[model samples]
Target: MLHRFDSFLASRRRFLQVSAGFGVSLMLPALEGRAAERRGAERATSLITLWMNGGPSQLETWDPHPGTVIGGPTRAIDTSVPGLQIAADLPRMAERMKHLSVIRSLTSKEGDHERGTYFVKTGYRPDPTVTHPAIGAVVPYQLGTDHLEIPAYVSLGGGEWPGRGGYLGDQHDAFRIFEPGNSIQNLRARVSDKRQERRLSGLDVVSQTFRAQRQVQAERSLHGQTIDKALRMMSSEQLEAFEVDQESEATLQRYGDSSFGRGCLVARRLIETGVRSVEVTLSGFDSHANNFETQTARCEQLDPAFASLLDDLRERDLYDSTIILCLGEFGRTPRINGLEGRDHWPGGFSCVVGGGGLKSGQVIGATDPEGEQTSPVDPVPVQNLYATILQQLNIDPAEELITPIGRPLAICEGSLIPKLLVDAG
Candidate 1:
C-alpha cells in the first residue's frame, strides 16, 4: 500500500545486476548525484543506530511503570531534557537529555526474537521468505553520502544485521566491518600494489570464463559485490576514522573503558570523518534470569558512555548533522518472573532519539501503567519511528526499492510523526 516509488524503483533493481554480470573486479560510482537532486532536504542528516541486540526489558528501562510491582529495584531520575525521566542509573544521560526525544509507545506484531529484530531494523515485518536490509543499508541507498571512500554502512561493536539490499541487489548491499578494534582487519598495502592487482586480475579471468558460457543473467558469481567490498576494505584508508586510541586519553576515559562505550566513540568518530551510517550494537539484553539487576548494570554501562557521546557530538559541533537512535528487538515483560526477570514483550516498548535536528525534549507516544500493551495515550508504531527518522535525516520515506523479480516495496511504510519534525519543533 505504499504510494511512492512506482516508477524508477524497478530500474534501481538493475544496480545489483551491474555487479552480478561483470563480477567484483571493477567498481562504479554510487548513486549520489541522483539523491542530491531530490525535492526536499535536511542540513542535519546522518544516522547512528545504537542497537541493543537482545530484547531489553521495557518495564525496567524506557517505559518504567513505577507504581507497578514490576517496576523493580530502581527509581526514575529527571533528565536535562526536562519532562523526561529515565532509570536512576542514567544519571549521565540525564544531564544531556534536553537534546533527546523519547518515544514510549512502539509496538510490533512479531513475537519471536528474530522477527522482532527484523521489524525494528528494517521497518517491515519479517516474512521468513524475503529478507529485509538493515537501516544502515537504507541510509546509503537513499542519501548515498557526499563522497564516501568506503561502503556507506558501517557496523561497529559486536552485533550486526545479516540482511542486505532486499530487492536492491548485491551492489546496494551493506559492507559490514566485523572487527571492532580496526574497521579493516589486515589491509596493509604490500610491497607492490601490483600484487593485489594481479590477484584481482586472476579473479577477473574466472569471471570472464563464466560470462562467455553465459548464465541466465550477466551477474558476478565467483567475485560478487561482497568479495569486491572486502577487497576495497583491504586497501581503504577511510578506516582510520575508527581508531579510538587515536583520541586523547581524557577523551577515551570520558566515554568509559567498556566495550560498548568504545563502540559509541568509534561510531561518532566514523561519522565525523565520512561514513554515512555507523551502527554500534550493545548486545547482552537477554537478561531472563536476573533481568532487573542485569539491566541496571547494562544501563549504567550505557548511560555515561552514551551521554558522553552526545556531549562529544555537541562539543565538536556534529550534533545537528548526526542523528542518534537507541533501540532493541522488543521490550521485556511487565511482570517479573520467579527467576527475578522479565520475558519478551513485543506488544510495546520505547526508543531514544536525539539530534538530526529532531523536535527534542518531548515524548512522542505513551504506554500505560503496569507496563501492559495498550493503546498509547498517543498511539504509534515502529514504522512511524522509522519514517520520522528518515524524514529528519532528509530521506524520502515514500521512496521505493524493488525486489529481484520487480515488486516495488516502499523503503519506509508509515508516515513521519509530524510532531517529531523540527519546523513543528
Candidate 2:
C-alpha cells in the first residue's frame, strides 16, 4: 500500500537526519570536527576544581615575589617548606604547606581571554575546526565510576561558564546547579510518585519505538546509549544523594554558610558517595579596579571553606583518594595597572594542587623577582599542567584520542611534571 512518492520523501528525511547526527566539529575544532574521537579517562581519578573565573592576580596569591620594583604591596612570607614564599593573604596555605605545591611559572602563548581559557580546559590549544572537551566531559565519557547514581560531572556555577563536553557529545554535559535553589536546579522531578513512574515508562515505550523504526546504525547506537543511561538514572533509588540535606544537622554546619561552602560540602558528599568529578566556581575575583579590597574579602570567603573541605575529607578518610585544584584562567599583572587593579597577566600565575596521593610540599617551578615574569627553566605551559593532572590519576598522558573520522588527536601533549608524581612507576 506504500506509495513511491511517500517512500522517497521519507528516505530523504532519514538521510539528512543521519548526516546531522555526526558532525566533524565533534572532535577538537582544529581536527576538522572529526567524529568518534575519544580519550581514555582514568577511572580512579577524582578532581574538585575551585575555579576563580575571570582572573585572580599572582601578586596577591601563591606567587608573591616581593622586593621587586614591579611587585605591589603584598610581601612574600616563608611557608613550612624551605626556600618557598607566598602572599600574606594565603595564611592558611602557608602553615599547611606540607600538603600543597606552587607552579609559579605558568605561562600561556594565547593572550586573548576566551582562547586562553579554552586551551587550559582542553589539553590542546584552540583551533578553528574541532571544539575540544573539557575535563568535566572527559571524566564520565571515558572514566566511569561504579555504583554512582548521579551524573559523573557536577558543576556548580552562579552563572553560565564557557563549559562544554565538546566532541564527547551532549550526554557528557555537567549537571549544572546554582544558588537560591541551593541544591541542583531542575534535577528534582515535578510529578508525584505514581506520575513519575508512569512518565518514565511512557518514555521507554516511545524510545523503543523510535529505535525500532529508525535504525540507521550510528544514530541508533547513540540514541540507544542515551536511553540506557537515562533509564539507569530514573531507576536508581539512591538519587536522593544529590540532596545532601538528608545528612545530619552538624554535617551541614561543618561546611559553613556561603554558597561556596555549601557547594564544597556537596562536592565532599558527592565524592564520598562516588561521583567522579565536581567543579565548584566562586565568582567576582576578576577585580580589575578595586583589587585589594575585593581579593581580601574574596579570600576570606575562600579560606575557611577551602580549609574545612580539605579537613573534612581527611576526617572522613577520603583525602588520599580525592584531588583538589584551585585555579583561574590567568594571573593579574604585577604592576598595578592604569586602572589601579592588576590587569590580565598570562606571563606567570599560580595554581594549588593537593591530595590524590600526589607528592605534596613541593614548589614545582619559579617566576621572576616579583612573580611578574616566568623564569626560563621553570616554564609551565597549560598543556603540561593538564598532562600532569591526567598522569596523577593514572591516565596515560600521551594516549591518542581517536577522532570520529579516524584521525587520532593528541590528548595530553606534555609529560607529567616530574615533581608531582607520587606512585608513578
Q: What is each predicted model's overall lDDT from 0 to 1?
A: 0.69, 0.65
lDDT tens digits by residue: candidate 1, 290-358: 887789888977887788889877877777878899989888777788898888877778888888778
| Clash list (residue pairs), candidate 1 | 20-219, 20-220, 21-218, 21-219, 58-332, 81-97, 81-98
Global fold similarity of model 1 (TM-score): 0.84
Task: Please report, as a residue range, the 10-residue window in candidate 1 with the lowest summed lDDT.
Answer: 1-10
Task: Name the lDDT value of residue 163 in candidate 1.
Answer: 33
User: Per-residue lDDT for 1-425 in model 2, tens only?
Assistant: 10112332254335334433221011010112211121122224578888877777776778776767666666777888887787777676677667777777787765556666676667566766676777766755666555565567777756335356666655455656675115432234555768766765776687678767787753724555543454455445444545666766676665556788778877776676566788887777777898877777677667766877888766666767677888888887777766678777777777888888778888866666644334434778878887888766666667777766666776668766878876553
Task: Indicate which candidate wins on lDDT.
Answer: 1
The candidate that wins on TM-score is: 1
Distance (Å) between predicted and true CA of 366, model 1?
2.6
Q: lDDT at 144 for candidate 2?
A: 57
